[model samples]
Target: MSVYTQLTNDQFATFCQSFGVSFVRAIPITQGIKNSNWFIQTTDDVDGAYSYVLTLFEERPPADIEKMAVILNQLDGKLPVAAPLSVIESNSVQTDDDDKRYVIHYEDKAITLVPCLAGSHPEQTTQAMCHDIGAALAMLHETLQALQPAEQYGVPLYPWADVRDREMQFMPGDEAKLMSDIWRSYTELPLTTLPNGLCHLDMFADNTLWNLQKGEEHLTGLLDFTEVSVEHYVMDIAITINDFCTTWGMAEQGESVNFDRSKMAAFLQGYESKRALGLDEKRALPVMLAKAAVIFWLLRLNVIHYNRTEGRTGDNIMVKNPDLMKRLAAYHWAHVEKSQNTVFVLSGTTSDNQIIGVFSSITQAEQAREKLSNSSEFAIKEYTLDQLS
Candidate 1:
């Protein structure tokens, strides 16, 4: 059975008391791909008065948890992120009636508490925000290039290039092949050289939060470091762009939504502002984006889809928007090809077919390139159609 489970009011209150906090109420927060989270209110009366977010770490071991926390704490000082908080002098959230560690025992499982961060997740991406996110990611990659950790945590045992290799073991045949091919092509593209760092491997839209004040939203908090790993920084960027920038008709219809390119630019601008990309990185952006798409595609196929086939409720979002998983995979393939050609034909004007191959619309691609040229902060050297092969 899947690991997600809910804590009753009594269990929540008792858990709070053990942590030297008085609980007033508790509400169910969204369950992530790995952990089940809850927002607990406390009588502490502090500005960010919430006690903490409760996460049940079912799949990850204690050592993995410790490593993730340590890596994130190191990165938090340098980036805009909310790292995990360790429970001092205790192995569990509470001791049970049978003298078992409630949080550590099978019933509570690998439960943990993290300080709540104040912010809302961005429903849509903007160019400015994308820039900030890009810059932050670049800076993170640069910083991570230097630091070496005591131990490697959550490194993929199998080749990440093929999603099928991993999922086929659990799911059999052509269905698996389709999933794997989509992921392999998207993730395995050669783009910017890989630089090692403590990467937040799971940087989806919901995991990142935006602080709102006076009706304006700014990037504030990044959450859920459970999938934290030692990997390439570009991987994170690819994942964010693939998930947030692309529009899935099925997913949108189910959730009631539309696409916003301005938001995409906002995030990219934010990321680029902090850590400027070289020609290599820029040229490789689409391939990287494809790699990111494949990771989430597999995540949905393996975890979310697997659950639904077995008749489960833990992943309502995936279950509700089944078509999204397929649409995302298709979109990534289309964009990766476009980005690769665009980078190749940078110096001279490109033919309509070549431009179309890389970008969904030639006009939109041209506009994007033009915008990059006009922006004093971010300037891209022009490429003509004739020069592109």
Candidate 2:
């Protein structure tokens, strides 16, 4: 997380009083990458010591950031979301106009205070936790699908075309070629009939909070709504699975990246429990996974460029390793190359289709086939994947 704009304790205290809040302390939050965040402590006569998260919109348009309040308001009681708080204005009283949003002008930058969500990011996610996260995302999408016409969320999908070009100049030959191939595969893929709606396009592990009880972990909350926009539900699922199911191994310590099959299984199980994936979505998932990896790889490369060009360091910059995204893209593309990547589905003429598994290798497919051989009404078939020519 980066704090581009600095605020003194006195400045914070005065700002707190505008909402009838007395400041106690502020601690910089170093987990976020796109925006500045601070953990705020406050006290008042009615409520004793309380905590909140103070945020400054760095890259997002202020108007879009303000619209987040509306989205959060929609999700307040429905999900484990930390909605923005309204600050009192004019003689310490709050009204409709005065409380349009929690956002305020701080040094000419947009800032908002939201309740600090419970739980913390899990260092390593388990299959069960992945399941919980999957269910939560399904609920998030289902709830948002009602808000129609794409105008509700004023944000657009990341301009991958423009970003890919800008960052490719700095990339090496192999990396650049890989990026170009993935971009071509992504843009040429058919997405016209995919289920589209408002989606949290970035569902990285760090953005989710979890509570470990006894021996199992439960997904308690979600963060970072800045990237929410209208997109394909399948694409949203791909973004999340790439982050939650993949194990970077000791990669942070210079090892290898691996995707966990069991974790992916559990995640898909939970997601289907809420909303089952259609045939077209299942067919598109593998390529979508690769595309998701490509998007983040390029975006993080851009983030590195921004941080370095401005001579930014420390809490003023939050940069993720674009290399990991590269490795992830490579891994998924290798599977795509193996050909006919799709989830397990029964396609016999006399029976209802049910997705039972997803794999890249034929041996795994054979094993699944053997298991289903006992049932005469079930048959395994290659998915009719529409890859870009």
Top-TM-score structure, candidate number: 2
TM-score on alpha carbons, each prediction: 0.71, 0.84
> Candidate 2: misplaced stretches above 4 Å?
44-50, 91-99, 250-252, 340-389
Relative to the true structure, candidate 1 reaches a TM of 0.71
Best by lDDT: 2
Task: Please provide, for model 2 over 171-193, each residue's C-alpha lDDT reduced to its tens digit, 9 standing for 90 to 100.
Answer: 88998888787777766767898
lDDT of 1 by residue, 1-389 (tens): 12357668888777666555577776666545556667778886566456577666766666566665555556777876655543333554554332322233335356656677778776565555566666666676666555565236444432444554756687557546655665556445553365445676666667777875534657677777667666656667767766566554543367433334455555556666676555455545555554565555566666665565656563323233433544555555565445434442222243332232234323234335545553333223424344643
lDDT of 2: 0.76
Looking at model 2, the pairs that clash are 344-357
Q: Once superposed on the true structure, which residue ranges of model 1 sit more than 4 Å away at CA?
A: 1-3, 45-49, 88-108, 143-147, 150-192, 247-266, 308-311, 314-322, 337-389
Q: Single out the weakest 10-residue window by summed lDDT for candidate 1.
A: 353-362
RMSD of each: 7.0, 5.6
